[model samples]
Target chain A: MRSDKQSRTPMGLKIAAGLGLAFLHLPLLLIFLYAFTTEDKSYQFPPPGLTLKWFAVTWNRPDVWEALGLSVRVASISTVVALVLGTLCAAAVSQTRFFGRETISLLVILPIALPGIITGISLRSAFNLAEIPFSFWTIVLGHATFCVVVVYNNAVARFRRVSGSLIEASMDLGADGFQTFRHVILPNIGTALLAGGMLAFALSFDEVIVTTFTAGQQATLPIWMLEELVRPRQRPVTNVVAMVVVLVTFLPILAAYYLTRDGDQISGQGK
Target chain B: MPHAVTFQKVSRHFGSVRAVDAVDLEVEAGEFFAMLGPSGSGKTTCLRLIAGFEQPTSGHIEIFGETAEGVPPYRRNVNTVFQDYALFPHLNVADNVAYGQMIRGVGKAERLRDAEAALEMVKLPGYGARKPGELSGGQRQRVALARALVNKPKVLLLDEPLGALDLKLREQMQEELKTLQKALGITFVFVTHDQGEALSMADRIAVFNHGKIMQTGTPEEIYRRPKTRFVADFVGSSNVLSPAFTRRLGGPAEWASLRPEDIRIGAEGGHEARVTGSSFLGNATRLTLDMAGEKLTVLLPAGSAVPAPGASVRFSWEPSALHLMGTET
Candidate 1:
């Protein structure tokens, strides 16, 4: 038997939910639609015509390849760096209390909370002040600042969820610090760290604002698209590259989503 | 024989709150010692100190005659069955039990064998492949016990290990725990707030309150001869005679404690009281009486005459039945 409220889907709520989803995702759907459009100069409302031509056109472009290569390299290196630094930061913050501990956490998370433009401008000025030339390493360093925040958020939430008793129990059972970490803490946070790393990777791969200020000569995919948009080269080629970016960035985001969906639940706890 | 565990004037404070006040205690080797107290009484804090989870603010602790001041929990020959069991969620039953051996660099095959043997000891044999989440509450608790026992430490520290179980399961585990402790002959330091649990399972019970031990004795001694008003009231339901009444009754102490069963309710007795309430408690009938305006409880046999409310009653007790105790705030 169903209660009066159990089965009814209110019309207002249904339309509101539909509008909210559309407002967020419709532009992304349009990006996919334009990737297959035949129009090269102007974006037609209905895409005017559809074709598979841009896919091939995108494969042949060496400039596109160079930009993609740079983007992939920068994102890969940034994610690796973020994972190490972020996990360590999360562990220290979650496990110990010291003077200015909360302040340290706030400072670590500040980059992500501030607008991307502010982070970009600040990094640019800091680099200029230090006389550090904008290069591949500079771009990676800039991306890592925010990437670390993403990983930190995930790892700390997970570390907090893990019971302190398990660590104590492991140590009492004759396991040393490293042994306890290996046999207990690592397994507990493994999925969370993976999800964090994946999200960081996805975020770095498509990063444009920070990359724009940090990359002096390097043309990452977003930087190249910006250039192409300004110069008006076979515009469909840029749209085709956008398609690749969507797919590339979409995978890690998808995996991260799945990883975290049930990540709150530990193996022994639910039952 | 050396004591299995000892604490000398130990204290642990968190900020301003003294979680474990300065106190002294000793547990004999191969004995089932229980620390029984209410919440915030520092019983759990003492257990944590022995497990090396918390360091004493001052004073000393020794395990088996060795100073435990700087030794980490891993170096100490002790294992714990935590209050929530604290079994590793990532590992299956066998792997969880085998963790201690694995850390010691034992081969996988041998550790699995030992784990199985331990599971058998806890009577959860052959459930090794199952995950901790797959097991029921009682089964997971047994897995935790098995995991700790596999280490074969000199002492097993159980911090309310059965605290999460249902009442029925808890009683069953209590009996099994007593039997297991006797068979293993290892020092078992059990902490619980339930006095009944402490009485049923512990060879010696240490009653705690306000970060201090109120009394430490055999369960019989604790039940029969509580040393303070706190212990008398805390251990079981007892008629605590007021200071004036105690002095008037010719008792030596400021206050006296008497168990309900110790009172004789009959016309032949000397003391006179008015029955205020009566209730049947299966095997016994308990009557609440007002004697000189102070309430006293008397336990009568199940078949005895029921005393109606407002009836005048005569009750008396032998001089030896009174356990005298000091005052309290």
Candidate 2:
């Protein structure tokens, strides 16, 4: 029956899918094309010359390396913190029936759903009111706020998929609470946790808006790119850094997809 | 034998819904006991209470003569095979079976040895390396059994263990489990909605309904003489007839219950009735007759000529074959 419908798919749908793919990738392709162009400041379609000079220049820059290292450190630290906090929050909220549970879940998810600018401004204001020094820790804290939402969502979904009977069976087999969680619950949700952590790291790696507010003078890679784009010297190298950002972010997204691919098929019982 | 597990007037209520209401039961040591009921009849809740998954709202539960009021499931000397066979999907069969011993701080070598032995007991010796998802339903179920039984608990609880299997596999597993129980001589408390399963495996069957045990007796005693209408309907197919006035045959509140096989269709001094329907059942042809504004079904031996629909027939059975039940409502 599905094959019958597939054979009759409308021409409009095929064209729509084609146009949608082009709309999504055309900007990224243009960015890649401009990264190799010889032009210094202009954003023109057909460049006069293509050169590998800017790629070399972007590779040797010490500031670029520093920002890259900082971004990696911040993203990794934030991902780990988010994973722990998010998994704990997901487990707590998923298993218990308590007053204000729905409200707490809503508050936990609100940070990601709100506009990034709003979260940035709110964090900035909170930091100002508390007289806290803005540094690497602040940037990590800013990124972790939104990263927790990603990990929380994935972990909660995985926890919900886990059958309650499995926990009961583990306990019945003479396993204590911690042992049941280790042997039964952790293995079932491990993939989801990994997927969520990868996505969160990717999101934090190139995040500009929230990082801009939290990182006072500390230049993350995205901040460095923003500074390079505004200045006039060797502007094509900014595009080169942008291309690097795309690659850095793209691999994790792919990894996340692969990690979560089998999770979707785990629901229905196989014959 | 002393009771291995006892529920002393235990009750559990989920808000207003009384899942297990003020119940008392005793499972004897080394006996295969079954709790039989329909869905939502609290049989599983009773099993959970005994397993320490759910604490009773009111009264106490005792396991092996010890009060189980504050004991957790892991500390209790009982293991359960859940209905869905909740085997860990990530762990191989050996690791899954070894989990309990590992938690108890058993050495790695000892744990592996015991897990392999348990796997062998379930007749899946080489299946220790396979994931639960890689195994068939029956194989997964056996792995779950191994996982639970490897702990060697004093009592084993099975909650509708064969519910997920097909008819043939369920029957086969029933005999295998009964044999395993007898060989181990551990107290087995099995819960199932299938009366045939309970009757075939259990040394004593407890028929539960509406959060209460309607009757508890041996399979033959419960099937041959049901004390209540609910027990009669649930245990097996019965042609419940409302006698105009039943005379007490023996003990107080005892009335006759006519088994379909025992009620002969063309016997001497039988009541006359019109045949309403007939069903061919290989060994016997079940005939439904309308007698005194009530439908009565009788089983006639195969190869016997079946009367046409609306045809008059006579049915009778010996008085000794009639089971004595408690007073009808």
Candidate 3:
């Protein structure tokens, strides 16, 4: 017989869980709703009308395309730089012991832990002091500072989880340093690096504070949307762009979650 | 022919802890050599040194006459079956076994065939498609053996390879390993903390204590004539008699060892003792006796009459059974 008493969740807990989820996601739902609303001047709850006009409008805007292209390029380059730097840092910190190893790891993760504005201000001053002109690379540099922290956090955790014997066994079986890394280390940590890169890309795509300090005249999508918010010009178009941004960032985060949820189930874990 | 491995005054110290201290060891070619010790007794450290995983702090080591101090593990002609099996979790049984050959630039088809043959040798044939995690503990251990054997290394180092199995499987593997070692004619250097395992499987056993070799000899020599108190106490629960007790027992005033099985109960004109405890052990009955403030153990045959606890009894051994040893610590 089915044990209904134990199997079913209490009603109060179910209601509380539903309320908690709604509280967290209702604003995102509103942004989606507003994107389809026909009235572009202001938000009207239970919208006065609804139409597919804003999607067409957003599709034709050259300024929107330019902002998107810039954001994609910046996020891509930032993620690449972060992957190389973060994986190396994680490998060194996790696989070896040296003076101030813990402090160095803490410093690598400090950028993400601090407020974005703090990182933004310090990066801007450092760039200015170095006499480097603000450009696309400058924005990439700013994003990579925090992007590296995300990748490092993921990669370091995975590196620690991999058993040291795996590498030793590879070497014992006649593999050299490079061969062992390729055949053993890479397969063990590959999914973790991929997940870290995905998260880093998502973080860089929606970043505004760091880009504001680093970009001289560049208007990334978020910066462009911020400007459009201040000066009302077809507000639904901005909501439409916001909808696209949500989808773009959300997909990667979702993919990363699925990739890492069962990561502990890696073969030969307890053995 | 040169010895398969040799250590000349080798010492490996981890800071203040001397893991393997100034030990000279030699393993002849085509022999199954076992290093037996308790935990922290340096048996594992010696195995790592032979594998080139750790360098000696201040000593010379040679493997088949090659200077082995600075050589990396990959450059050495040796393979290891780790205590935990250390099978590659991500690879299937076949790929894991084929790993060594794959590194030597052997063709895929040839390596896989050799891997299958290795599995057959370990009695795990046709298990190549299965991952290490899917195998039982005994099966994983066999896979590890197959992986090491596939390389055809001159020396095979086993770090307590059967330590994880249950009693029945352990005994089975012990025989299988001895047979395999004999068939291959490769020098096998096995490390283990279990004394019975060392006695049963090793052609020669080195008893280690406190980062030093207490005694090194054949299993029979170690069992019948231990060189020191540590070797006597560690290797079979042999009764270690103090110098005073040995003198009273009509022997010289020196430390000596008496095997439990050597004591015959109900012998005329022998030491008088009272049984403190007695327990039946399948093939034998073990009785703990106290004689004149000295504790002694006697192993009675299974079908023999066993005395009840607190019973007074006379136990004795032949004079040759009392093996005396030096005063070295």
Candidate 4:
């Protein structure tokens, strides 16, 4: 049926789809092209020459490495924390019923639903009011607030799909609660968690607004790139870093899509 | 020996809805006991109670003479083949069958071998490495059986295990399951709404209605002599004669049940009835009759002349065939 529809798709719709793709990717294409341009200070079409020199300059910058290390660490720690908290929250909210269960889930997801600036300001004020020092941990905490929503969304969907009978069968077969989780529940929800965690990682790695409010003295990779765009430093180096950022963020999203694309293929699903 | 499972006035209530109300039951060891009822009649709830999945709201339960209140399903000496054959979606057949042993800390190789033997017992010997999704419905049902049977529990609870299979496959599994139960001598508590299945497979049957057991007896007893109108109407299609109809038949003015097969057509001194409908049932011809303003059904043996819809006929049964029933409980 999908093939039948694809075969009959109007020519206008096909061209419109192509245009949509180009509109989304054209800026990234420009970033790629300018990363190799020889010009240093100004934007120009059809550069006089392209060189690998900017790539080398961007590679040798110690500030680049420091910011890159900080961003990776923050995203990594935030994703880990999100996976644990998000999966637990998803399990509780989907698998049981109690007073305020729906409200608790909504609050869990509210951080992502609100604008990033709102979450950033709230975190900053919360830290100030508590007299907690702003450092690497503060940025991680801010990123975790939203990262958990991503994992919770994915894990909750998968949790709801796992049949209640499967859990009962496990208990009937002599599995304790912990053993049932390890053998039955974990394998069923494993892919969803992985996909959710990868998405959380990508979102955290490129985050800017929350990090701007949470960071006191440290600069993440995105913050570094934002500052470089305003300054008069070698321009192609900024484009070079943009290329790295695109690759770092794009790969996990791609991997996440592949992991969950056939999510409905779990055994005994419809049976 | 103590009964395989005993329930003394067990009642499971959910928010004022009595799912199982004041039910007393005893399942003998090594006998195939069936709980037969329509959907929401509490047969499945009773099975869950014995499996320790649902604790009774009141009264006591025992498994092989041991008190069973507050014990979790994992601690019980019973396993259930769920209605949908709830095989783990992530595991292959061998691992699924081995899950019970694995939880007991049995070595991997030994459990796998035992799983294979259990699969063999279910007549699905080698098809263990494949995932359940790859197998057909009947095969998944067998895999579920193997998974539950590998543990060698004292009681095996089957919750409409063959309900998903086609008619031909259901009949085939029914034969295989009855033989397997007798061979293993494990107490089998089978729950199903199909009266034919319960009659053929169970050594004793408990008929349920409105969250209570209407009758508990051997197949012959339940079929030959039902105690209430609900049991008579449910166990098999019977003509529930009103008190007026009973008096017209020269019996006391009380509710009575007469089996359709027991009524013989074209009998001398039989009550006159008009044939309202007739249908061929392969081995027997079912004739619907309107006798004295009450509906009656009679089975004519194959090769007998079936009366037309407007034809008038007379049918009668021996006095012993008319089983008197008590008031509705």
TM-scores for every predicted model: 0.87, 0.84, 0.90, 0.90
- After superposition, candidate 2 runs with Cα above 4 Å error: A1-70, A92-111, A122-138, A213-219, A234-271, B241-256, B323-328
lDDT of 3 by residue, B29-68 (tens): 9999999999999989999999999999999999999999
- Per-model fnat list: 0.79, 0.63, 0.65, 0.74
How do the residues A76-139 of candidate 4 rate in per-residue lDDT, one tens digit apiece?
A: 9999999999999999999889899999999999999899999999899999999999999999
- Candidate 3 stretches with Cα past 4 Å from truth are A1-62, A97-106, A126-133, A234-236, A250-271
Superior candidate under TM-score, 1 versus 4: 4
Task: Report lDDT (CA) for all predictions.
Answer: 0.88, 0.86, 0.91, 0.91
State the fnat of candidate 1 relative to the true structure: 0.79
List all candidate RMSDs to the true structure.
4.2, 4.7, 3.2, 3.4
Alpha-carbon deviation at A173 in model 1, angstroms: 1.9
* TM-score: model 1 vs. ground truth: 0.87
Docking class of 4: medium
TM-score of chain A of 2: 0.89
Single out the weakest 10-residue window by summed lDDT for candidate 3 chain A: A262-271
- Residues B112-171 of candidate 1: C-alpha lDDT, one tens digit per residue: 999999999999989999888889989999999999889988989999888889999999
DockQ of each: 0.60, 0.46, 0.58, 0.61
Summarize candidate 3's per-residue lDDT along A216-252 as a digit string, tens digits: 9999999999999887668989998988888877887
Model 2 per-residue lDDT tens digits across residues A99-156:
9999999999999999999999999999999999999999999999999999999999
